[model samples]
Target: MMNATEEFDPAVRSILDAAARRPVHERRVSVDGASLSGALAAADADGRVPLIAEVKPTSPTTAGTRTEDPVDLARAMVDGGAAALSVLTEPEHFGGSVENLERIRAAVDVPVLRKDFLLEPGHLDAVKADAALVIARFVDDVGEMVTAARERGFEPLVEVHSGAELETALDAGATLVGVNNRDLASLDVDLSTFERVAPGAPADVALVAESGIATPADARRMREAGADGLLVGSAIMAGEPREATEELVYA
Candidate 1:
C-alpha cells in the first residue's frame, strides 16, 4: 500500500487509503472475453478512432451521484457506438463495485475494463473483467502487476501521466497504454498532456487518451495526436449517456 505521508495528492492519497482498506474477496462474475486491443484494432481497420466509454457513477472530483443502473448506462454507451466500456470498481472515492462490472460485462458485448487503484496481484483475482488498469504511479512493482493481470487473462491498460511514468510503463512491457490528462497529484486537467507524452511512445503500442475529454473537437485533437482510443467518463455520465456518447463516437 502507498504511504499516506508520501507526496501524493490529498485526493489520490484518500483513494489509495480506501483501496488499501478494501477487503480482498472473490467475486462471482463472468467476463465478456473481449479484447480491448482487438477492439481498438477493429476500430482502426474501420478508419474510426475507438471510444472506450466509462461507467462511473461518481468521482472524488465530481459532485453528486448518478442513479441509473450500470448495465443500462453501459448499454446506452454501446448503443451510441462505444467500442468498449470501463467500469470503476473502487467503492469509496469512485461509486463503483465489482457487481456493477459483472452486470455491465454481462450486458455488453464489447470489452469491459476494471478501473480501480489496484495495488497487488491478489486484487486482480477479485473481479471478473476483460481488462485491468495498472496505474504506474500507484504500484510499487508495475511490471509484476502487469504480468499478474495478463496471467489472469486480462489485457492490462497501463496508465501514465508523465514522460517518466510512460517510460516506466513501457519498461514494464505494457502494450496498451492510457495517457491521462488529469494530474492525480493536483487534480488539474490539461488536454495537451497527451500531445506531449504520446509522441514518445512507440508506434506499435496502442495509446488511449484519458480524462479532460468533453466534445468532438477534443476527441479529434487526441486522435490527431496519435491516440488509438479515448476513455471518457464524467462528460458522458453527466447527461444522456447515449446522446453524449454518440457525439464523441460519430465525431
Candidate 2:
C-alpha cells in the first residue's frame, strides 16, 4: 500500500513548478464588494451551492476524477454557473498545477482560487502568476501571508477540514472558511462530515463545502446542512454538459 505521501499526483505538480518562475511583484488588483467568497455567498444565499468549477485529477482520496483536458474542462466550468473556480495547484496530493491555474485564469473571468498547501510567504512567492484567491489551510504563518495576499487585493479562501481547524482558520483572519469533507489522511468521502462542524462556524464567516460532491443531490444535502457554497471539482470534471451548471448551482 502506498503511504499517504507517496501517492503524489504529477499533474498537480507541473503547474506549481511553472508558477515558481513568475516575476515577484505585488498585484495592483482590487475587488469591489464582489469577491470569490462573496460570489459563493450570493450563490449559496439562493439556496444552492454555486460550484467552484474545479480542474483537478484524482487525489489522495478521489482516486478516479481524471479528465482529458483540464483547461478545456475549466473553460466549460465557467459556462456552467460556477460562481468561482478552484484550481488545485498541489500536485503531490491533488494532482493540480499552477499552469492549470494560469490557464484557468485566462480561460475565465470569474475569480481563480489557487488551492495548495499554502503555508508560508515562500509558497505565496511561488504562485505569483495570476490567482485572485489564495487558499491557506490554517497555519500560524498565515497572518503575514494573509496581509500579503490582501495587500495585492486578493481575498484568501482559507480551508479547514475540521472544527478545530476552522477555529484555527478564523484565528488566522480567514473570513471565508471552506470546509473540506474528504479527510486528507483517509481520503474517504464522508458526506455527513460537515453537518456537525458547520453550526460552529461563525454566522459572518461564509461556509463553503469542499470535496465528495458527486451529484445534484449531494449539493442539496450540503446546502441544507448549512453550507453557504460548494467547492466542487470532480463531479463537474466527470463530464457534464455546460448547462449542467444549473444542476449543481441549483441543487
Candidate 3:
C-alpha cells in the first residue's frame, strides 16, 4: 500500500481532501451513462487513429493553455473530428473545474472523460463525464479501483507509465489502457516512452498514447506504435483548435 503522505503528491492530496469534504451525492452531475470504450474503439474502425482532444486550461508544467470559452473549445474539437473529449477537472494544479466538464458535456455529443488524480470511489460520483482517469501508481489495489469506477457507471481509463504498470493494469481487468509518456516523478516528457511500451500491450485492449504528442507526425508515430487513440492537450490547445485537431485526427 502507498503511504498517503509520502506517495501522494501535494496536488493529489489537495484534490482528495477536497473530495473528502463534499458529499458524493451532492457533487454528482446527472447524465446518460454512455460507453466511452465503444466510442474509442469505433474511432479506429475506419482505419484512422482517433484523437481524444483535451479541454485543459492549465497544468503544473504549462499554465493557462486555454483562454477561450470551454464550450467553444469543445465545439471546435468536435468540428475537427475528435472522437472523444478529455476535461481536466483537477482544480488546483490544472486550473480546471467540474463546471468546465459539465459545460463541455452539455456542448458536445462525444464521450467526455474527467481527467484527474482519482483517489476515492466518490471521485467517480463527482462528475457526469462518461469516463474517469485512474492512475495505477497512485492506488494500492488496482483491481478494486477499476471495479469501483465501473460500478459508478464510468469507464476507467487506467493510465500507466511503464511496462510493469501496464501489466498491473491489464491484470486488474482494465480494457482501456493509457500510456502516459510524461513521467510523474521527474515530470519529463520522453516521446519514446510510449513507443517502448506499446509493443508489450495486448492487442485486445484499446491502447491510448497520452502526452507529448504535438504534431501530425507525432500522432502518426503513436499510431504506428500501435496506439488506437491519442490523448492530446497542449498541442491542440496552442493553435486553431479545429485545424490542429483535424491535422492530428487525419494523421
Candidate 4:
C-alpha cells in the first residue's frame, strides 16, 4: 500500500505555468509585520501562540464541509484572532486554487502561507506571485524547496511528521517549522511527537503546531512545550470560522 506521500506522482506538477501572466504589479500586496521573524518574536512576546488560520473546503482524509469560500473564511480568520492565514492552493487533492489565495490576500491584511503539494519551482513561483510564504511539505526535498523559496523572496515553512523529517527541514535552512500532528494517513495526532521533535529544532527556528488542536488546553500545552505558533483549521471551522478563530488563537 502506498502512503499518502507516495501516492502523488513524480510527474505531476504542484503549480501552474500561467502564474506569470497574473498582473505583475498585483503579485505581492501589502501584508502584516508578523512575518518569519515577526511571528516568532510576537509569539515569544505575547506569551500566546500565534495562529495560522487555514482556508479549504475538504480533504481526502476529512471530506465534509460547507461554504468553501476562501475570501469569506480568510476574512473571518482575520476578524477572529488569527495572526496569519494559510490558503491551500492545491486543486487536485484539496480543491484549492490560486484565485482563492489571491482573493483571500486581497481581502485580508494578515500574512498568508500558501499551503500546497509544492514539489516544483512552478509551485514556488506561484506562491511568490501571490506574495505568500510557502510551506515546504515534509515529503518534498526541504533544502531544494528552501532554496527555491528564497530565490523568490518567500519564507519557507518546513513541515514535518516524524523526527527523522525534522533534520531534513533544518538542513533545508527553514527558520520556520510546522509540525503537523495529523498523519493524514492515520488521520490522528500524537501530541507527544512534538516534544520529541521540538528538541531538535534550533533556538533560531520558529516552531509551530499543526493539526489536532481543539481548545485552550491544547494551545496551552503547545505553548508550554515551546511551540512558537499554532496552525489550526477544522476546529476553527467547526463553529463560526470567525468565532472559533478568535477563541482558538486568543484562548
**Which candidate number would show the highest TM-score if scored against the true structure?**
1
Model 4 backbone overlap count: 0
TM-score of 4: 0.80
Worst 10 residues of 3 by lDDT: 22-31
* Residue-wise C-alpha lDDT for candidate 3, range 1-251, written one tens digit per residue: 24466544455566556645655543544446577778777888866568899988877677566778989999999899899999998776677888999899988999999998776666677667888898887777888888887776788899999999999999999999999999776678998999998888878898899999998889988888888889999998888889999999888
Stretches of model 1 off by over 4 angstroms after superposition: 1-5, 25-32
Candidate 4, 139: how far from true, in Å? 4.8
Q: State the lDDT of candidate 4 residue by residue for 119-141, as single tens digits.
A: 44555555443233434442345
Measured on C-alpha atoms, candidate 1 has an lDDT of 0.89
Please give each candidate's TM-score.
Answer: 0.94, 0.77, 0.89, 0.80
Query: What is the C-alpha RMSD, rounded to one decimal, of candidate 2?
Result: 5.3
Q: What is the lDDT of candidate 3?
A: 0.83
Quantify all predictions' global Cα lDDT against the true fold: 0.89, 0.67, 0.83, 0.68
Off by over 4 Å in 3: 1-32, 63-65
Clashing pairs in 1: none
Which pairs of residues collide in candidate 2? Answer: 12-91, 12-95, 12-96, 13-91, 15-97, 15-98, 15-99, 16-98
Across 1-251, the per-residue lDDT of candidate 1 in tens digits comes to: 23345686788888988887876656533444579989988977876569999999999788899988888999999998899999999888788999999888987889999999988878887878999999988888989998888877899999999999999999999999999999988899999999999999998899999999999999999999999999999999998999999999888
